[model samples]
Target: MPNRTAVHSELYSPDSADNPSLNGGRCRSCGYVFFPPQRYGCESCGAPPEKLEAVQLGGRGTLHSYATVHLHMGRDIEAPFTIGLIVLDDGPAISSTLANRTDEGLAIGDRMKSVLVTASTDQAGNEMVELRFAKAEGSK
Candidate 1:
């Protein structure tokens, strides 16, 4: 059993605590892919709600954009993190935290891969895992 649970059941794939893939929705009608597994109709083409199908991303993406965080923003999360917008191989761009936060070491077009990381802890002290993008080895 996974120690972590996605807000929605279809949000993650291989549905395990270890190295689960991000489950995105692809619009069969308009080819729009979304990270939240689009249960709603496509806003672009007004495709019927059911047109969205769940697809497992390859877990690899190219860094399209990024922002370095400096404030905690009243959240439980820490500061000095990197938030990246990555274009996945499967055609959807998703936002995730980067394992490496330093701007000096990160660059646009760098290859990133999804990996399980701790989001926080539960009242029971169990870790909550979430997907994060990290610099792939040999990918500068």
Candidate 2:
């Protein structure tokens, strides 16, 4: 069995899988949503600093843009990997790997859903997690 504590520490620390889904900072006073989780005053309507709150976002989205990477920093991340910008159904867009498929038949405007996946092993031999998108069940 995997060491749960080590796995959690490696995969769930800071910003990888702890929150799994993307989040935004919402202005409590004006309901403005800021992607990348703002820590200061609101960008919309200039709300005061005290009104910001972390909001969990739904990970369902559509493919906005994509690219098939054949090469990466010395790691050779497997050829024909599809990386895409997913525009969340209710919030901002994020860049993530499109899971369970190669780039051969992928196209823009494809619908996808976010999923947490084991990315790889770290230098310490612990598992790492990352967010990825995949075709929704029954999607063409």
The candidate that wins on lDDT is 1
* Alpha-carbon deviation at 113 in model 1, angstroms: 0.6
lDDT of 1 by residue, 1-140 (tens): 43664533456642454445787777899797777676778867889988878777678879999998887776755788889999988787888888776566888999888777667768876566666778877895
Provide the lowest-lDDT 10-residue window in model 1.
1-10
Clash counts for the predictions, in order:
0, 0
- What residue runs in model 2 are displaced by over 4 Å at the alpha carbon? 1-20, 74-79, 122-126
Give the CA lDDT, 0 to 100, for residue 41 in model 1. 89
Instruction: Give candidate 1 regions above 4 Å deviation.
Output: 1-10, 13-19, 123-125
lDDT of 2 by residue, 24-137 (tens): 668888887666675679887888888898777776778888888766665635665888888887767778777854676667888888666666766676555556688766
What lDDT, from 0 to 1, does candidate 1 have? 0.75
Candidate 2 C-alpha error for residue 53, in Å: 0.7
Clashes of 2: 0
- Model 1 vs. true fold: TM: 0.82
User: Model 2 clash pairs?
Assistant: none
